[model samples]
Structure formats: C-alpha cells, structure tokens
Target: MENNKQPQLINPAELFNPEPYGFSHSISVKSPFQMCFISGQSGGEGENHVLTDDFKMQVQNALKNLKIVLQSHSMTFENIVKITLLIVDHNQEKLEIWVAEAKKVWKGTFLPTSTLIPVSQLALPGMLFEIDAIAVK
Candidate 1:
C-alpha cells in the first residue's frame, strides 16, 4: 500500500524576504501530477481587458480574473501552491491595502507561497497589476 495523502502546506515566517522579494517560502509538490500554469492575468474581461489604471481596481480585477482561471480548471485559490504578483509601481502603502484585500479572498488559511515583483511597466500601459499562479490537484 502507499500513502496518498496531500503534503502538509509549509509556512516560513522568516524565510528571508519570503514574499515581495522574489523568493519562495516552500515547494510542496513533487512531479508526476497534472500541473496548471496560469498565465499572468490582468484586470478585465474579454475585449474589456484594460485595467482601470488604478492600483486598487486593477488588483481587484486581476484577482477576479484569477478566480475565473481557477474555476475553469475545477480548482480554487486553496489549491494554489505558488503565486507571482507583478505591479507597475510598488508602494508600501498600496501593498498594505492589497494585502488586506487578499486576506478576504485567501481567508488567511492555506496561504500559497507567493512573490511580488515591482516593475516599471506591465504588458499594457495602464495595467497596474498582473498575477500568475501554479497549482496541482
């Protein structure tokens, strides 16, 4: 017989700039399973994929878009083990707000290892945020 239980989620509080520093807190999954690599999703829907040019709105829309992707694969944010966030202008104050909003969606349980990168610009001019994720089921 073999144990088929899911690996315990790893959390590193002081993983040396664990988040917002391009570092991962943990790698929980092993090979040999179906993997989903979601592309960097920006705020908006088809033909209306233009971000609002506002950080908060862009962040909201981006997260909504991510949800759609997750649903398409029959998975939710809980299944996500890793996430990468890209921001056009990274500000600490704005980040605080973003974190608050994230908590609402993530529920502070089963937090996925994440990274946030501050870039000068995204794929679009007005885009303020983009999120990409990887998950296994």
Candidate 2:
C-alpha cells in the first residue's frame, strides 16, 4: 500500500521562485519513509552503454533511464526529493534545453529540489549530461 504521508516541497517567498528552472528550493520528508539514492545516469543505453552525440537525445535518454529506475523501485518522479544534475559545457542554450526537457518529464507535477553543476568533463566520453536523485517513499 502506498503511504499516506507526503513530502513537503518548500519554496520560501523570500527566495526567487525556482519552479521555472524546474526545481524546488527544498523538500521536507517526514518519518517512516524509505529512501532510495539513485546513482548518476547518463544517456548510455543497454549493457554496452551506447551513447549518441546529440545533447537533446542524451538528456532525454537520461531522463528515461531515471524514470525506469524509479519504476523499478515502485516509485515515480514525484517521489524524488532531491536531484543533482551535472552538465558539461553548460551554457544558455544548454540550460534552455535542460529546462525544457525537465519540464516535459515533470509536467503538471511538483518538481524536486535540484542542484546543477557545470563540469569540464564527465566520467565517460560523449557524456554531456548526468543526473542522480534521492527519492522518499
């Protein structure tokens, strides 16, 4: 059975609204909840970890992978409390793309707390984006 207790998504008025950026300021999860810490996922697919050169495709696939992971744990994006995003060569264009893709994934739902870090490179070649999340159940 799904738990009745729900996490509290916070966005204090004092702080700039972060929803447009596809995240909340913070999340307060109460007791008696199970937490799942998902590993960073990239656009790599299948056991071979094949990836494409397209940034949009990479972001889309990464989100798909994350959704699959969440489903495996009997959870959804709504269960996510915190998400960390890593982007290589982050820029205005990339940021716009990320926001647009994120909105598509988290559409009509409360977004999770998030932090995005721009790095020079990632662990693997052709990896432009990576996302990790913490979910509460």
Candidate 3:
C-alpha cells in the first residue's frame, strides 16, 4: 500500500546561509504562480529628485519605489519572494535603521527572501540605496 502524505513545506528562514546555495535568505511558499522581476530602483523623484541626504531617508524612498513597482503589478510586499538591496557606504548603523524601517513595512509577517550587498557607490550621487524585487503572483 502507498501512503499519500504531503511533505511539510520549508520556510527559507529555517535554512542556513541560503545565498551560498542560490536560494532566498528567508521565507518560501508552495504554489504555482507567475513571477515578476522589477528593475533596480533608487530613491528619488525626478531630475532634481534628491530629497534627503540621509541614509535612512534614502532607504525609505527606495522602499517606496519598490512598493510602487509592486502595486503596478497588483502585488504587495507579501507577494515578494526575493529582494536584493544595494547600499553605498554600508555601515551597521545604517543597516540597523533600515531594518527598523523595513519592520514598519513588513511587520514581521510573511518574511520574504532577501540579500543585502554593499557597493562603493550607486549610479546616482546622493543616493545611498537601491533595491530590486521578485514577486510571485
């Protein structure tokens, strides 16, 4: 006789150092859906878009831009399966602030896979951070 038991789903967070294995750093879902890839987004409004010279503000704006892209596809952060963050002048203090801001948006629910990278500089001056996201819908 064959048993018909479903396998337990794995949350990416439960995995250790998922990046080395080319997997998300956290959270995964079992589903058949389409994936969406968003281009790298920076924090700015227009040609004169430099709003705040602060790292925290840049991080916030980057998240806002990410949200806009997701909304355009009728999605939200909950639908995000993977994200890559690029930062210039990376520092622990900045990361801590960024994490705090992210908590406001994510609220410790539906943790998505993510990667953070430190870079020398972004394409634009006065921009401290950029983010790209992949979503399943």
Q: Each candidate: RMSD to true structure? A: 10.6, 11.6, 11.1
Residue-by-residue lDDT tens digits, candidate 1, 1-137: 84434433332231122245354423334456645666676775454354565788877877777776666656788888899988777999778868987897899568999999999988667887888899887
lDDT of 3 by residue, 29-85 (tens): 234554666656667754345557888877787787677666655678888878899
Sort by TM-score, best first: 2, 1, 3
Clashes of each: 0, 0, 0
Question: Tens-digit lDDT track for model 2 on 25-78?
Answer: 345455777666666778877656688999999999888887877776567888
Candidate 3: regions farther than 4 A off: 1-32
Residue 28 miss distance in model 1 (angstroms): 17
Which has the better lDDT: candidate 1, or candidate 3? 1
Q: Which ten residues in a row have the lowest lDDT in candidate 1?
A: 9-18
Over the full model, what C-alpha lDDT does candidate 1 score relative to the true structure? 0.69
Ranking by lDDT: 2, 1, 3
Q: Model 1: runs farther than 4 Å from truth?
A: 1-32
